[model samples]
Target: MADRLLDAMARSASRLYGGEAVSELEHALQCAELARAAGADEELQLACLLHDVGRYAVDPSLVFDTGEPSRAGPHARGHHEVGAELLAPWVPERVAWCVRAHADAKRYLCATEPDYFARLSAASRHTLRLQGGVMTAVEVARLAVHPWLPDALALRRWDDGAKVVGKATRPLSAWAPLIRRCFDR
Candidate 1:
């Protein structure tokens, strides 16, 4: 079962990364690795690894494990809505919603909850437009239906944690045991 999950993830990562950057599989795996190191729960760790699984549904190109030269920011801007639509079918609604919204939390939080703007990346100071505009009120309203909003929000926080290069990202293997633990819980 896990093998199938990882395989499906490989496909999503391939297309969503915009013909450049790390394969979507690599990045999603990295996110899951990160969550595992930080002691995140199985579902959340699973969320980290497969957040963008939606990409597979939207674009099969992402399903491949191919590599390409990326122009940097396109991975963030190009994939979110498509990711959301695709994920709605394969995973829980909240996981898909949070994954879709991970890159643009500031805008949604900023408009609805001004305090959130302060939590945005310090580096984002120079790349506002480059990161894509914030999520719209309608989108935010829709995502609210996600059953795992709080968990999704935490996943969003860790998404940022997983970004720094060579930082101590936990390995995906570490979550295997954790995944089992979650079932017993």
Candidate 2:
């Protein structure tokens, strides 16, 4: 039998990430390997792999399952918000915050610092102006609310870096040996 952790990961994916081309298993596995190859620490590698596991609490519809870039237009559905809600129970609040904050890395820029202020996408800039809740001050407060905030930032960066396109994207099964190697260490 697969280990319980692996099993839980699989069930979470099946429950929340079905039908979308973004296979849950594959996405997590790729994130893990990306973190690992990039020399991230073990916890971060795990975070990379499981960050979206919270999606299990959201729709089982497969919408968050694609790598399509969010373009300027009608707001489509997103998993990070609901996924953040799902993950709050299982990991550090900062981890969940990372997932939520990642959905619109731009929103955080508007809510918080001035450094990234100018780089904002035109759509995200519009989102910021529209008012009151694309990403609220409360969420920003929570994002800064954890000691792991730095770690969460790192994990989010790692997550973004993992989203390569097409066949160049690696497979989950390909990482089983790597996971085993890490686990055995």
Which lDDT tens digits does candidate 2 get at residues 36-93?
Answer: 7779876566567766654443344532332332431244345565566655565555
What is the lDDT of every predicted structure here?
A: 0.55, 0.53
Q: In candidate 1, which residue ranges exceed 4 Å CA deviation?
A: 1-27, 37-39, 54-78, 112-132, 135-147, 173-185
Task: State each candidate's clash count.
Answer: 7, 0
TM-score list, all predictions: 0.52, 0.49
lDDT of 2: 0.53
Measured with C-alpha atoms, the lDDT of residue 48 in candidate 2 is 73
Weakest 10 consecutive residues, lDDT, candidate 1? 63-72
Q: Which model scores highest in TM-score?
A: 1
In candidate 1, the residue pairs with backbone N, CA or C atoms under 3 Å apart (3 or more residues apart, or in different chains) clash, namely: 11-62, 11-63, 13-24, 13-25, 14-62, 15-62, 54-87
Best by lDDT: 1
After aligning candidate 1 to the native by TM-score, how far in Å is the CA of 94 from where it should be?
3.3
RMSD of each: 6.9, 7.7
